[model samples]
Target: MSDWLSDQAGYVWLIIAALLAICELLIPGVYLTFIALGAAATGILALVFPELGAIGQFISFAAWSTVAVVVGKRWYGANPVPSADPDLNNRAARMIGQSVTVVEPISGGTGRVRVGDGEWPAEGPDLAAGDKARIVAVRGGVVVVEAVKAIEADLPDQPRDDQTQSKG
Candidate 1:
């Protein structure tokens, strides 16, 4: 068995590498990729030095696998491929940084806000109806907001005794 393994170490390593590569595809964590690289390196080394024994080839494979894992972690960890839209799974989380209107008065940091046609529960500083607010963050089903501007307060004064403005 030892003689056969010593003779076929290179071919065995190559096959192991191919299997690892397939496993990496089946489970996509990019972890098996490093071991696959190591196996390929060992296969090449065995092909170059066919006189090396099976035990020596196994030792070389272990060393190569360790180095590959460390290097792969550093290179891939430092620069990862970011998703195009990270918050695509959560619609509420994606709504941060948007301007919304205070649909109901905010008191004790809880109220309702309107973003486009939808209304949502919000928590933030106290604000009256018609106040412009900005969505800062989302907490579970509620959004955290801050008063941006009081649109009605910023408007110019108008006459209150107009005929069309009388209440029934």
Candidate 2:
């Protein structure tokens, strides 16, 4: 048994690498693949130097695996994957720069504004009903708004005196 184990040193590392790769699939931290790479590297080294001592192999595996995990973490972290919805977590950020109507009068910079089907608490200068305000920012679950100039309605030509007179 001892002689067989000694003759199959390279196989031991290859098996270790295969096991680690499997473990990586079960794990969530995304760390085991680096160790598996190091183990595979050590296995290749063992195949190259059949006369190398077991202690030397163990030390090489330890050092290589540690470096692989550390360096891999650093390199992977340097580049981040761009998410599809980066603002998904920040609900208030989506409301910034939108326009909302004041459903309730704003007194002392506090009021309620209607945006779509939802009414959100707002903070801004005093505004009355039907006032138009532009969302500027969000603070403490409240939408901050600034006054926006209201667009004037288009008017046609003035009617004549007879047209303005009441019908009999």
Residue lDDT tens for model 2, 45-134: 888898767998898899889999899989889977788998899878888888889999999989999987999999999999789999
Each model's backbone clash number: 0, 0
What's the lDDT for residue 117 in model 1?
A: 92
Backbone clash tally (model 1): 0
**Distance (Å) between predicted and true CA of 168, model 2?**
37
Candidate number of the best TM-score: 2
Error of 2 at 155 (Å): 13
Per-model RMSD to reference: 7.9, 5.8
Global CA lDDT computed for model 2 = 0.89
Clashing pairs in 1: none
lDDT of 1 by residue, 25-83 (tens): 99969999999999999999998999877788889999999999999999988999899
The per-residue C-alpha lDDT of model 2 at residue 135 equals: 95
